[model samples]
Target: MEGTIVRRVIPSDNSCLFNAVGYIMEHDKHKAPELRQVIAATVASDPKKYSEAFLGKPNEEYCAWILNPEKWGGAIELSILAEYYGREIAAYDIQTTRCDLYGQGKNYQERVMLIYDGLHYDALAMSPSDGAPEEFDQTIFAVRNDRTLGPVEGLTLNLVKEQQRKRSYTDTANFTLRCGVCQIGVIGQKEAVQHAEATGHVNFQEYK
Candidate 1:
């Protein structure tokens, strides 16, 4: 049930909505009422700057979509600067969902899983445009999954116990006598010695 699709967000169409919000949020943070009025007007007018800012240019190495819009959401905007290959990238904005705003409910784990899966798919699709091949992008997803599920606790202790057990049984031929006080050679050596002593022979011709 895995699938992927690739498409670029048109700068003219997408950047306008995003940029309007960004402008309001960036410049009118202290003026909440004014910001809201401006946002409403911008959304009503449907400016082009919003979408353009999103897919416009690479200002930084990584861009993020800020989920919460009320606090920071304005159409589409940059939220954080991320480092990618030693370069900084702007963050993109996304509408915050009920789950993101208020936290998940009973199906929290499932919801989180879905979110992660979607992010992986999007990252794969955007990899090429991000200057990485699809194969390399796949590796990023694989590493993310690996680290998310990797055992972090009690690992050292488990490895130590396993190593001890491995060493203890390494030499199968070494055995303890019935008296538990002396070592015996291989099973054949013990049997040969038993036969010689039982028959009271000084030397039993060695059997090949």
Candidate 2:
């Protein structure tokens, strides 16, 4: 009765967060634009709730930033998407193997999983068994069902172990990046942010 839970790799098109959410919610990987619209519209409509201090930028500017397809999504976007879809989202981190549950206190009926390798997001699904194709994958699990939730968590931990064995996780704190514009090198995400803030260069590529 237990199924095989596996990681469904998503393309690194800067919208992997949206794509992974779409894959789990609708089985469609191309739902970035519409979901981005949802976030933009939601923020644009509620200025008081999503004020500049909360968003770390002006509401309008954050809205525009999120609407841009080239930008990446994080906790803010995950929380919004979880509320929008009315389901709890559990993101499993590769580096820490910690699960961050969004919408936990909201009493959502169902839950979905997303795997984070520090830099990119991917969907997690369960097939009937090993070697089963993704067409047979089940993305949603009942929140209150221990029978389902227990095994899913077990399998996800197994997958995380495999990924860690293969060194598939990124150490964002120590990873090196080079600005695509000026080719200047920076260490870690904080330094990369500082470089971007200082030079107005947004493009960066990770390098060994």
Candidate 3:
């Protein structure tokens, strides 16, 4: 029987993307360190592709930055991990409600899904039944068949709508943040950037 589609929320410990991918790929949430190491190795081995100009920093520096648990991952990491794992990663962005396909045109026959709400990530899976435990969840999908992907797309869109109605996201532009280093209040992403630039303090904790 078809199962219930649900979101597996990963911890927001700055490794949410890695953890989300880990959960979807291996049903393991503690693979962040290993995944980060893989990313570093992948980038280091291919300086031509992940160049300073492309990475916006020296290859070594980028690798070092990503190794830090405090750093967040996005498109670069997504693409790298997709290539490393040989699966098409479909990331559904809550803000745009759009699916960004990674590893597309690569003849990858397998696919996995994740949801990004600007600041956090979660794994998308299909459990054996409603309210079933995550151990019964299926995170992988087939991509070679168009019909096989139909229900998955529908499931992702339904999840997007569900999260939208719940307002389960932070408004990065207007969300308030307090500098953890200085305990100074800042409003919105711009102010946070300004605070970081002015005081060289990048540690911020969001507040309602």
Give lDDT per model, in order. Answer: 0.25, 0.89, 0.87
- TM-scores of all predicted structures: 0.15, 0.87, 0.88
Candidate 1 matches the true fold with a TM-score of 0.15
Per-residue CA lDDT of model 3 for 1-208, tens digit only, reads 3877899989877789999999999999988999999999999999999999999999999999999887789999999999999998999988778889899888898999999887789999988877898989999988745524777688779989889778776678888888898899998877976777688677788888
Give the distance in Å from residue 75's predicted Cα in candidate 1 to where it truly belongs.
5.5
**Number of the predicted model whose TM-score against the real structure is largest:** 3
The per-prediction CA RMSD against the true structure, in angstroms, equals: 29.6, 2.8, 2.8
Cα lDDT tens digits for candidate 2, 112-176: 99999888899999988878888899999886544237666788889987887787777999998
Error of 3 at 70 (Å): 0.9
- What lDDT is reached at residue 122 by model 2? 97
| Clash count for each candidate, listed in order shown | 27, 0, 0
**Candidate 1 per-residue C-alpha lDDT over 1-208 given as tens digits, one digit per residue, 9 for 90 to 100:** 1322222221222122233322222321133334334444443344344344643533221122222122222212211111101111111111111112111121212101101110110110212334444342211111123222133112222333443444321221333223112322223335534643454332222211
On lDDT, who's better, 1 or 2? Answer: 2
